[model samples]
Target chain A: MYHDNYEEDDLAAEVELVTSAQYPQDADVDDGFDSEGVVSSQKQPIAVEIPDTIKNFITYFHRNVLENNIYELHTLYEVTFNKLTDRFYAKQPWPEAELISPLVDDDQVFLTLYRELYYRHIYARLSPSIQDRFHSYENYCDLFNYILNSDFPVNLELPNQWLWDIIDEFIYQFQSFCNCRNRIKNRSEEEIALLRDNPQIWSCYSVLNVLYSLIQKSRINEQLLVNKNGGDMLEAAGEYGSRPLYKMLGYFSIIGLLRVHCLLGDYTLALKMMDNIELNKKALFSRVIPCHVTTYYYVGFSYLMMRRYADAIRAFSTVLTFIQRTKQYHTRSYQFDQIAKKCDQMYALLAMCIALCPTRLDENIHNHLREKYGDQLAKMQKGEDSISVYEDLFQYACPKFISPNGPNFDDPASLSQVNEPYQHHAKIFLSDIHNQTMIPTLRSFLKLYTTMSIDKLAAFLEMDADELRTQLLMFKQRSRQQKWITGNLLEGDIVSTSDLDFCIKQDMIHIAESKVGRRYGDWFLRNITRFQDVIATLEHKN
Target chain B: MAQLAMNRPEVIQSLIDGVDRYNPDNISILEEYLATQCQNEEYDLMANLAALKLYQFNPHLTNDRVIINILAKALTAVPAPDFNLCLYLLTEPMIIDESIKQLTALHQLLEQSRYAKFWETYKSDSAYEQLVSEVRGFSRAIRSIVARVVSMTHQQIASSLLESYLDLSGDDFAAFVKEQNWELKGAIVQIPVNKDNEAKTVVIRENIKFEQLTKVIGYSNEM
Candidate 1:
């Protein structure tokens, strides 16, 4: 929807012919971007100026906001605003909310929405300064306070996509703040003091409080339950939940909690957040492609960490296939690049899970995985020398883990130990891999014979029989995991995860492998469709 | 509701499954609940991890003894990734402490199913005893895990090896086998056939459900 016919090369140009046609206040004023004589007191490399077109756009945006014209806002949010961003502020921050407040008549709601995009742009393109972080946090508090605690049924409406983005970006910034807070190095004394003093800014407790409060205020859990099993919708929605604004926010907040808990390494709690919302083509999260990809990304990641490899494989495969099937529909989304990036990361994770668990995958996903991670997957399955391969895939694909607490500013010595959380997670996961390092070798040996004495197999592997026995036991235990059938993500039955199974009696080991049966359904369906096509063609010819 | 904390205590279920998990004041409640789990030999990884999670955000509330107890209980749920899940929540310095290192050594031995070595190191130093002082019957808890893994992997184990793994002997081993409904034949202990130990050939066919076929059925109406 963005026309990239702009001739302006400056990151903060005032306007271009492209956006000016709609607003017509195009004052192509570029006064060399002087850093001095800036309006706000916050020192910036580029000065903040309300370009005439954006100023005009904001006034029109204010009218649309007043009318609650979500249809207009969707085009404005998904296309016009982004096209303007690419034209004017591609490499620079948007005009500050305060700087443009006058153009919108100081309308708090519009200014709040503008600031959301303003700070989101800073986070996306430029590095957000500490003040930017704090002020953006305050702006969020203002926005949420207006919607939540306002005595009236707030006369505001938002498209579902924007609502999801609000929650998504809110958690993103919170996670960003957490990771930033963990790094206390290379910061000025003033920045450190600001961070140390205002401990509530982007605090974990406060962030979770906002998400949970959204869920509770909207009574979203009850609403979801009523939707699932028939019930009184009005009673379930209560007052706030009846409003789309509150309902969507609350629903997305559940997803926000999933991402947050996964970031905190609470994998079980991550999945626990999605108890009511089933992962399907029709879930509200699927309406936003990024949200859909994100939900599966975290769910798959949590399952991988929780040692449920089969479930992880299923989660990753389902979403990867969905993305492939629906590619044409969302390739133009504003977050398409972000979605594609997550799509690639999920492929990497799927490769790792497939190598570890040996699950059959859809042909399309399998080909993509082989294309993306063939050599690494080969090295991973080679065993014992593939530690670095696993770690590289993990680092590339895993969520950015947070340490939850900020640096102990009281002790400067501890500040240098910032890599502790990442190292901690890597160590735990690598050790888990180390336990199964002997599986490939043992599996080959097991497949060679249905019944073999443990002592004889140990001789071939040049190890003690007792040690071989231990490896076999490890295989038996590791290859069985809890899989979701029809319930909350956490509740699942313990099913055999491996294609191979074995039993040990006295000194003898017996091995068996489960193979997938030949499928006639797909072949019949394909033939039936072809036959129908032939019949239709013949009848049309007559 | 996902608050299906199933078997967990109501107070703990509410606390751990809600925003209260972030509350520093509620940690003592989880801590006390952890102590009860230890006393009853009733391990709950979710609740224990919740306690560690609270300690993670609130450094002041961290109790090394409670952490050790939690890890010790996690040692009972070995091969489930519970111990490492708890370890993930602990800071680097806390994980590398002399006490945690000693426990980790036992944990490694146990994970490798080196039951004999685990029993040896677990009993090696007085510090090991002092380290697990908070856990009421840490030895019994770990023994049950060993007993479980052994039965799952073996239909019959040499009595000497089983005794070494369990760290029980003669009459104690016999009594243990009897309690488990297992029998002691001359040189081997015969465990009852269970699902995991049976290892029958299973053909995992595709489970195509009626709902998945509804679309195909719709095409039949067109026909």
Candidate 2:
């Protein structure tokens, strides 16, 4: 827990103290900043007076690495590295706090040291195996949180960077370590304890959480831009500082808000939240340059919730332009492709909603919907009698709108902006639509079968087709001699005196002769014929 | 085991329909009277009709296992019950087919073992043992019939069972077919023969094995 004693005024005082301590003669302090605003000790760069050997080593290390606080590692570098660098890193003769003043945030410096000390204690308690990965930012944060919350034994304060080192080690080796026999195959008590005690164990999943947050934020920012007033507000605010801040914060809030609304069955709130982005769109553009394209698609979705056909179509069409552009590149921004597909799906659903409307006004709307959603619109018109209401709905709802095997928006450029998992949700959404009267049973089955492979079908039925086929054959052979044919079953009973007659009468012969579904249907007919032959032979013998 | 006429499918169906007309206690006597009265009448008609009616409610209820279990419970209190009477009462189309094959197999086993009247007593232990010994291959055959029935449509199964039944009797089996009027069966296509030429016709006998039958069917008989 962080201490509450350091107020804003106290921070201002500390900053003034640091600035005054650093610049004694130049009292030309700006009116905007308080006297204690700057920390002076940290302002001093590492001195150049150190020996060439020491300076060279420090220079090589700096060149090889991204800039990070060095005081944490300075002591070790000084003691071991003096032979190489000739300059001492952290002499330890000076107070450690004073030595680290340059790197540490004044208010948080003591707290940071306390947390580091706690993590070291936790790390010391862990087994040697766990200790190996106890290096990195993530590991430090996890270990710090654990030690601070619990009573782990150890006496010294650990540097925050050292704590982070543990976490960094854990992350870099996480996947390979998990794959090892000691981690997965032979899950010893030590490994279990490591998992239970180590907070960094969950950090791997935290990356996905971060990604989701960024995506949500991106989406919200775009939505907020649509509204003229909200857009203006963001633009005006962004002029003074970072433009992406307000938009990112606004969008980050949408995922949780939308999720809660969805769970509460508050369709109105969900619709409004989705619609709000567009309502405040102008403000978003002035603030954030990289807004999520899915905002336009979801706005159309909100229109769908309201059952507003024309408006939904207009909103969705805007998203289509982005969809076309995003596909031109070989790889897309991770969420950009998702946004495009979502637009297409929303368009499809809008078509369905229009088709479902029971009004003469929807005639033009229905035609538009049918153009996209209907399988064979002209045929339905030609044979009006064949068109059932449910079939029309099936055509309109369009179960096959979302293609699972379609191209993905997976480019490093887009993904680099945010970190979120792109676990496609379209299939689940489509399945739900299928279940909720979007398509009739047979059509849905056909669509599902077309979308998924035969292998997947086996999983759905909970039986491998190859195994089932074998069982069926064995069953047929066993019943071959039985004279009694059940009235409940068709194949066992002879339909006609002649084999040709039976085949023709049952339409089996016609099916066999046809090239349609030649492989699957033909295979079925062959099996049926084999069984019939066995039945006929047994009857003759009897 | 004795068969309970009250539990007979026809009587039970009637009981279900005439819930207000017949007292639950009088069901046993009423069923017995009806069964006794209908003994001389055609069983196939009454049993098939009752089964077809019950089947409309839930097709799987007419399954062999389901029907057999019902019949077995009905016959629990009776001694030396007739299998034919039990079959008629239960009226499960699949069970009728299954029982016929089982009975024929039992007869074949008895005839082979030189004891033709083995199932005459029909006590629980004796009947179970007799059935077990006589038809060692019963379960497999029964299971296949059940599976075949499950696979086929109702009409296909009905026609197949009817055709198989005719074949079992073996005397101008087509007569039994003609008697049924082929209501349960689908359309049958007959190839027309020219009357101008005298052709030597070969009747494909029931004794032909599968391979031989296949070979025979394969040959185009010229007229």
Candidate 3:
């Protein structure tokens, strides 16, 4: 009953508020926080003065930043700040940064950080105008410049959560801008001119440069290598990577690139971005749970697009298990609901993958998938007209893919078509599954035979012998995948992923299904732990 | 694994490193790189995709031979998404072109592991030959891929089926089967068991180490 609402399709579609919502450890999970943005005509100008409560809150927030009191800042940023905004500026932008600058004593560094939140709040609640999006992009440049391009690494430190969010939000806004820029039919002439003239703004090249610059400045790759192999961290760190601020930003930037490349439909390049980092409980991305989720989400999606469904299933099941085991620890997190929604989406993705390439999933995860998508799974398996089912789950699970280039401003035809890069991707994926709609049914029939003539099988399936052979070939190809064995994420050896094996001997078809051997080790270990727990309970009672 | 140097031509590398990669003039340099990639087995997917991106924007700059060669190179990088990535960059009209359609027919057959049909359809069209004519050892490369896929799934297969899949016959087929080190016994070819096609039922048993038992031993001593 508690998680039933998370299965709603519209929950995570609004990406702004979740990314904008900061996570604090001891915060309450507020449910009625989804107030849709009420567009008002009078909200354009910086004509309003700062309210006293927000003013004091800004000053206090400024002092904590100055003092580097991350504990207080965490609470203030996640809970108090959002509560205050809901109470005061519900339908409008946070009072302009220039207007609030005096409250923080004209502190440039504090204001830069403040503007990060400021623009994010606008993006979360209000409609960001052309200028707002541009200014937000500028503010990101300023923030990264302060952290990266300083003559000396600035003596500034923020929470690692904030650092990760900065990169996350920067990319989110870039995605938002690209999507917005693609639909210029309603935009005024001035806006069109601005977009045409500022082609460099929010360009894929610029965004990639920023992430790459951070990676180089911090020497994160070298640091990661030193971390993997045996070496001195200080030496591998060089200068910028020594500090936590640069190290984490550079680290987060790698995960950031993993996400960015996925958005641009470069599946191999997406996984290639993870060459330096490993995805395990001990890896650095696991230091932050959201980063951990982000890493696996894109990795699994990329593998899915590449038709490596087994690898995709592995990635999803691992993270979904992690989330399930650690659900209690983060239930009180401000991002509790967001994390739950992501879990639900992953289950949907897992359902699609398992339907296509059936594998024995973890028992708990498999149960959850059946609970969430039982109807769709059955439909997908039966496969008469189930492309819509796959498309629905795909859209519900896949990232918001972005086009790398902007609209052709000179062409009126371009303005007519809004950016739907994900649809292009969906089309590619749907056609692939279309070619294999007969696999599940054919597999069911194939399991009943050790050897049979193609003509006999075709008679059963109501198809000609030639068509059946082609189908068998397709099954053979799809069952073999390039699985990751060891080393970098991209390099892998070809392996048989399917439990079912078949071959053609002239006219007869032979099928030999591999059975998963029953294991006593896991069962014994699980019961042993339960026995120990029961004994401990009895002893404590005595 | 990534530290291994991939062969990249300096002229093409310098151009791709900058905005000059999108120049219509640089298409020739990238085409040369694709030719080199086909002659040898070397591949640089990002470089080739960048070149395709240029042609997607400037349709006039596209060379049919170059597109076909890039797709051919992508075929070798199988199980990776390089081929589909190249397909995504082509213009709508180009994607549906007669030559492109026939070439993709070959791609689909191989991709679907319809090896017999792949060879059947490939030889059915002169355009398919003309398209992949630039790539040397093209049939050999395709056969190797076919062998790689078949070797993973079967310990022994009907030699006739294997020959059909490889598009080879008689002594040529025998030599190809020998190259895989498979034993040709009458109508069957026997492949040695490796990691994948062993098809053995494994009952996993836990192997405890001395280090793990040491702590338990200490507790026993205290008791």
Candidate 4:
């Protein structure tokens, strides 16, 4: 059956070619050639033999530009455009001029838009030196103007459904690009004024608004919510999977919603959206796209902001595990290498979380940390008093974790700008190690003894008695809920002030047994559970 | 007739009343029916409440994949604080009613690691006789956590102290210790220790000597 269909398709293509050759001028007027110049008269045999150069250009566009190799795409575009333009401008009459004119014009429009979008992606990944060469914001504004003024009618000869799908993806991506530009520029009043003054900007904005409204009107959000309740989650997952265009758009809508919310610092809403995506275990684990790593990364970041350390640890751990597994394959591609490097940031953030909450990293992750930040990690593990170790780890990790350049290089600002959110959180985590863990542990360690002279306790803690007393008094006042310590800090013996009286009076510290100590133990246990859940979720591919 | 309109408060009240009736089958049916109705009407809070009530009535239902689907939906439908009551249902199942003073006290006691006080208060609550099995299971989990915490510091504790902590009698305490494969020395019970062999032996000796010296010094200072 398939062979018969192939034969029929071949015959149709031959007949179409013969007809076009016999009446070339009539063919152009009658066919109303789409942007690609494919004759829409027959659906089965759309393939026509175009020049090899044109074929190469299309292939390069698909392989490099569509595949998100913006760096390579930029180089290829420069070479291809110059080569094609030289051939077109040569003094000799070009034999393929008729065939190539429409193709060139179409390429011009496509390349212009592609270049603008490509630079936006490039701005995210390139170093400052490379970024200075490209004015992405200006290019975007130029493209926006072109799109506003251009009367390029929707080609009736094209597959409208397919075209709309592409448009849908473009709109979604453009919205995200705008969002990043807005964030990266810090939404300056001057930029806002410029956008307001430019009427072309409004046209693009109106189109995005309409597109977004259409997406909302389509009830995709409500459907996603409803799917979580009782509907088949994989239903939408399957529909999106059927076509690349739908798949990209679907994945974008789901991921973009969460990312935008997280970027905006609406962590609660982001968390809620993440919860829905997570429940559709199929959607998360689906091979339609490897969204799990990106999804989990953002989810972890949001959880960190919300102070859900256990969940955050789980999320970051999943991202680390995914990167580790991918590393084992040793693909050595630039994209994979970028992802692996970003995982280093995950490691640093994971370390911060462990320090804050006292969770143990996996032996594998521990080994990885030792391998990367050997002496620093060892000092931290050995319970060194110096804050420099943590500071070094945080500084090393802050840039990578905050604006981790993924394979897509979706957000350009991360490359040049410090991730303010993670930077702020990293500081808090560092301060918390001192305030919440270190001080609390010291006070609880002292409380293990039934009673001890202030001088002796202070001597054991390596601080002056008066200073220790002042610190303890400050801690006591700060934590009004802690009833385990109550006494005059200035003159009396330091004592276990817990109401429950027992006779074991040795002044030995057992960190895991004390009230504050037990909290640390619980935190470790919670992290273990979180790690297990992350492993389970990642492995649950159906 | 007015109730048939299925307004927000009426729907929620109906769910509450259904749960009060103790008819699991009807409650299950109403849960699904009300969920659909609420979703259609965009009464998201009520939908989440109904889902919570369903999970509460048939705690075993959560084991079903479908119930997880409902839970995910419920969590997203409302803000975290609004769903606090439902979250409590999952975490503290035995204390179904927040208004119940005794159960509330039991929760606090367990949370605070006041095991001896908890057992005393639990025994006095004759009104919760029907909840003995559920409360006992919760108590065991809490006792295990306390036991782990206590054993972290002391190798040996007096039998009476262990009994107070575990709410067990002399023979029962000994049996519990035996069941856990721990050693007992007359009036004192030894908690099992699991550590790297070489390090464990070295640390134990050092700790014993240090503790003994500290005790002697403390006595001398007092004298």
- The number of the candidate with the highest DockQ is 1
Per residue, candidate 3 scores C-alpha lDDT tens digits across A1-542 of 01112222232232122211231222221112123234531243324445555666776778788998877777787777778878986676676666666566679999889889988887777667677778889988998888877888778777887888899899988988877777676566877898999998998878988998999899999999998997999999987889888999999999999898788777776787798888788998887778888889889988888787888899999999999898887887766766787888888888988988989888998888889999999988888678889989988988877777787777787567665677677776777777778898888898787777888999999998768866876777677777787897777776677778776655666677877556655565556656666876898999
Cα displacement (Å) at residue A285, model 2: 6.0
lDDT of 1 by residue, A407-459 (tens): 87888787777655777888888887787878877887887788889999999
Question: For every model in order, what is the iRMS?
Answer: 1.9, 25.2, 4.5, 19.6
lDDT of 4 by residue, A1-542 (tens): 00112212332333222224532331211112112212222211223455444444544444453455545554454445435534642221112222333433335445545554343232332211112112344454454344333344211121222223234334333433333332433444444344334433323334433333333323454445555677764554443233333333443455554654454334544454443354233653233223455566666666555445555676677667666776654353323554565677777767665554444566787788667666664456445763777777667654322211111123344334433334444543454344333443554455476445556777877888545533443333222211112221111121222212221112222222222223444455456556656766887963
Give per-residue CA lDDT, model 4, range B75-103, as digits (tens): 22211212222332332222233333344
Q: Residues A103-160, candidate 2: write the lDDT tens digits.
A: 2343243434433433332222222233333432444454344333334322233323
Could you tell me the lDDT of residue A239 within candidate 2?
Answer: 31
> RMSD, each candidate, Å?
5.7, 29.5, 8.3, 21.2
lDDT of each: 0.81, 0.32, 0.76, 0.43
Give fnat for candidates 1, 2 and onward, in order.
Answer: 0.65, 0.00, 0.16, 0.00
Question: Could you tell me how far off, in angstroms, the CA of residue A327 lies in candidate 2 after the best superposition?
Answer: 6.1
Question: Which structure is stronger by lDDT: 2 or 3?
Answer: 3
Clashes of 1: 0
> Whole-model lDDT, candidate 4?
0.43
List candidate 2 segments past 4 Å from native.
A1-247, A259-266, A274-276, A280-291, A302-311, A325-336, A358-373, A376-542, B1-223
